[model samples]
Target chain A: MSTTTPPRPRRSRAERYRSALWLLTKRDLRVRYSTSALGYFWSILDPLVMSGIYWFVFVVVLDKGGDIGEKPYIVFLIAALLPWMWFTGTISDSTRAFLREAKLVRSTSIPRTIWVARLVLSKGLEFLASIPVLIIFAVIFGAQANWNLVWTYPLAIILQAILVLGLGLIVAPLVVFFRDLERAVKLILRFLFYASPIVYSTLDIPAAIQPWAALNPLTGIFALYRSGLYPEQLMVFPIVMSAVISVLVLGIGLLVFRRYERAVLKEI
Target chain B: MTEPIISVTDLGIHFRRNKARRRSFKDLFAGSARRSRPGEFWAFRNLSFDVAPGEAIGVVGRNGQGKSTLLKLVAGVILPDEGRVRVNAGVAPLIEITGGFVSDLSVRDNVYLTAGLHGMTKAEVAARFDEIIAFAEIEDFVDTPYKHLSSGMKVRIAFSVIAQLDEPVILVDEVLAVGDKAFREKCYGRIDELLSAGRTLFFVSHNERDLRRFCSRGIYLDKGKLVLDGPIADVLDRYNADYNNPTP
Candidate 1:
């Protein structure tokens, strides 16, 4: 007897979005902590350890203290590090995200955007896991808290996520073509670490170069994150500009990624 | 017979090659150097085919003959350099069984990930979770990391997820050759079920037994061109005839 199946309709956009996001998130969370003793603890601990080292270097060794009006250096550093970690981790991992899934890319006909989005979303969750520590650090440092901080912090995360997603969309596909892009991203992240106002304040830059620093999308995100932890010392203009730039970057990145979507599978 | 679910026309894919002759230090100093041969290759050229819904088609060709490439194109994993491929329904390519599975994740997690990659929802996967594990027969290893599982186990889990996808069109590319006899038989059974459900299947395999058993129609590709398209038995007869008596 002949066993035959009828052609099923393609999934709608909403169904695709829901399925893709859930699967990616579950895979990321489970796989990341799999076969490890620490498991979920590592996500929380990774940033804590890094923050500790930076706090020691900047607070003790450098012995540099600047109120920046209200917030302490340690508080500022932790706030900056949280989002910076998310940005760096997302970009670095995303460079090889598609290539690592070469098996999937070459096999299935699922949308490529789903893969890139999964990496960004997973990193975003990891970023969220580091928040309690941020709060604990803030309370220990005697930083003032305000409701505005809540609004600003999430905004910062949203903006940074947009920027990272855009950058990832561009980088993930390119890395498939030029395998060296993976290495290139690592070098670029190191350079970006210093260029961004992560360890040092953007205020530290000379007046002549402050405008250029203001132009960086990350600078706005970092500023907003800091403001969220300490609202009184917030800078409004750059934060707004950063939000605008993040949206623009994300939009352009998605366009480029979708344009080259078909080519990526073939090349890989 | 229904209208073709997949249609391809004037498809071509070209690969560029840099044929610049390698010049030594001595050649660099000397102005007289011959140009190298042009480097260009076509993986597929002007290929076209139409596949009806619920039809089982077999793609047979020698290595590097663009059989896989053509499959990839029809699956929409890649686009053609020229021409077009149009599919009226969902296309699931079974080229790699373990596509987005993370070794660090459990077999349970990998199943969900695989289902997700094929565009199934969490609730949907959850509903079929028991059935999938039962089919794979890895209930004990469901919580274990995929990296810890044997290759055969991995294949089983991967196959189970794809088998449950319920996609309209399924593309199988020599993946069934990896498992043990029992497991292979189980997979064949699943394929039989899918076929009975009237699902469209496109398979690429060198196994004559499988080709004759599962496929109703066959297309013989040689050097990226369609050399034969007819009933499965007739195509196999011609293929065997050519194999036994190759042309000089």
Candidate 2:
């Protein structure tokens, strides 16, 4: 009997992996849109709405815009808020990466990291889609759009992406073993929102704790974000610190994911 | 001798005795999904096997005896605790084909999504798109949401996509029960063609006729141990005698 052996993958391994990740991320976006008439609207709407609420509370209600942030406070609020949305959204969704697609996770031989990375990319894409809104607010508020964004914006995005994906890698597998971590991830995110620099700049925090505040990776990353509008917010020390911390988080995430992936697969 | 397409060594997987079937969303599918108590049990242990390219092997065991777990290991979906499984080629796995799809997406999208998950590129899926839809006989419903399809149609669509994958190793998990007789005949024909083309097959089934039709070698598993490793007919006879079923 004449028989033909199966052909190997024509593309390199990395190419195949990337396409798989993209396909999953597309599926995620497609489902989100199909299920809700307002899917795209909601992704962009979230940051805008949050920016408005914070601007109203801190500036309108508290009358502290001049004391706390750059002028045209809405711009200040949204500049950091957009990326914050990506960070929190990715973190929140990563908690369920394995559980949500347990069957698919078990079916594919692709590196399990793709599962969590897809969430990071999808949420990051939403943040990208919402950038135009940030620009509009920046324009409307007559916020001084400086050239620092050319460098800092990209820097901040890379740092945040690394940070979020690392954290996702860590969280996705861990949640499979400890289901309670899923709920705990949410609670931590809720606390992280206030603890991060969304409502106020890291500089506004008391001098006594400013060093510790900068240690929150978001402080430097967000400062890089604000540099697009408020150049003075950019600082050498914190951006350097953010880079160091983001890379460290990613390193830890990789180690945790590798150590637990087998256990996670068994648990799933 | 051709190199073995798959090799498993000292294979063992354990489960927690306490985390039973009711644990969470995962347990919903894992009928035996992994479990644990303060104590533990090995779902499988000290088992090993290999398949030369184009070899057809049938895995026979009662339900919840880790038959699916073995396939999962070969498919590289789950890690073994005590041993290892190494595969030289890609796998087109039918282990819960219907579970990988998105209910809210259209058939077109689900096809691309699932095919991609199995590592099929866009060009490949698009090339096989019409043929896959034609095979599933769901041409009219390609644009419709997947959840809208009948359960039978869902399986047909999923199976069609998997059938077209160029991967050399085909892992079947008794999913041939999908669709009607005519559809099953078509599936049988497809499996036959792949086998004739020298694809390696690892099929798990309870039906003696199906096992005899596809596999020359059989591995009989009982209570997490390899009870016998021999010819299909003998393994079936042994399995039948052990389980008190009338022999063929």
Candidate 3:
């Protein structure tokens, strides 16, 4: 009963992947905010609440108000802290990005990299929305904003997004094969929180440990953010290091993801 | 004769068996050397076939006979380990009809989302939106979250969306088992329409009646090997005879 007919033209691979990425990212954001009353508020709420708590502990509890800098403790803490929330949130959630969508991952022909990319994009958006909170605090706290703010903020965001994407790409696929890595990722994030310059300036660190702290890619990115907020304290080394390290991390991530792409189906 | 639209040559796919067991921290702490080695199990091996355009192939198999795995391979969902599957036509797979729906999104959003995943462009989905909703017959619940809808409703929406895909090759895996008589009959009509339009098809089902009704060719699989391939009647006859007269 069937007759042969000519085939229709199809879209190119790049076009298909781009559409898939957009659709999946939109779906992720919608589902995330659908069930809760707070909706988009939750994205910024975590960092906002954490910044407030940390400000209390450092200034009121520890009486270190004068030592932080000329900037208010709240403003200084959030400059780097907000971006940290974006990075850590994307990393922790990405470990389960593949495993959570086991059904979609196992059944569809869409690229596996879509999962990691969607996580980065969605978290990156939330991170972007939270930026105004930093700006509002900076303006209110009389931060020494200047022309340097223009380049530093965008550069810091782009560098951080690249760094998180690379890390997310590596972890998303690896966690599928190694379930223990999921729990291990959380512990590592906690260690990294204190390890990076979230609460204290890198300059405050003992000269001995400053070298070791500079090795973290985020250390440089966050330092750039601090520099953007307070121009006088801007350090050039970390910004250049961040730009270089971000590219290296992205390259490594792409290699690791491609190698494990085919093997991931069976594990999932 | 024209070339086959789909060809499989010595295809093989295997999965790791001890994945979960190897992940157990207790086993690692206990130093159980035997459990540490992950074993591999072949889902299928050395499978080769060519499907011509406009051919509807029925895949028959027992549980674990790798019927779904073959469809997955054809759909490009899973890659083969040993050989290759080459298809000249774009395939529209109907496996796990409601599996891709996001529960929190309304039925309308899911239609767009699932259709987009199946390779439909945004403008295409937008153009066919009303037709899809009308076919699904869930106009009143269009805005209702997918999770709140009845299973039958979900199946109808999923089927309606996929039925509109213009891909030249179609893969179906028992998606007709859901919904009421009216809806099942509707789906059957749509499949008939696809076949009449000259689309190649791979229909996997354990139900012999359904297979015989929709397919002229049959491939019988047993224990991950293709045991028989011929006319639908001949394959079923041999398959039933094997069951009735067990060689001792």
lDDT of 2 by residue, B1-248 (tens): 87888998999998777665334546323543344444578898999888899889999999888999999999988888888898988899988888788888889989988988888778777877888999999999988999999999999998998988868999999898878999999998999998888888999998899999999999998999999989999999988988888746
TM-score of each: 0.86, 0.93, 0.91
RMSD of 3: 3.9
Docking class of 1: acceptable
lDDT of 2 at B155: 91
DockQ, prediction 3: 0.41
Q: lDDT of model 2 at residue A69?
A: 74
Misplaced by over 4 Å in model 1 are A1-10, A67-70, A231-233, B15-40, B237-248
Scored against the native two-chain complex, candidate 1 gets a DockQ of 0.42
TM-score of 2: 0.93
Model 1: what TM-score for its first chain?
A: 0.91
Off by over 4 Å in 3: A1-9, A232-234, B24-38, B245-248
lDDT against the true structure, per candidate, is: 0.78, 0.86, 0.83
RMSD of each: 5.4, 4.0, 3.9
| Tens-digit lDDT string for candidate 3 (B1-248) | 78999999998877777666545445324552222244767778899999999999999877777898899989998888779999887888888777788888999889899888877888888878887888889999989989998989988998887777768889999888889999999888888888888888899987788888889999988877889989998888888787753222
TM-score sort, best first: 2, 3, 1
Pairs that clash in candidate 2: B16-B35, B16-B36, B17-B36, B17-B37, B18-B36, B18-B37, B30-B33
Quote the B-chain TM-score, candidate 1.
0.87
lDDT of 2 at B116: 84
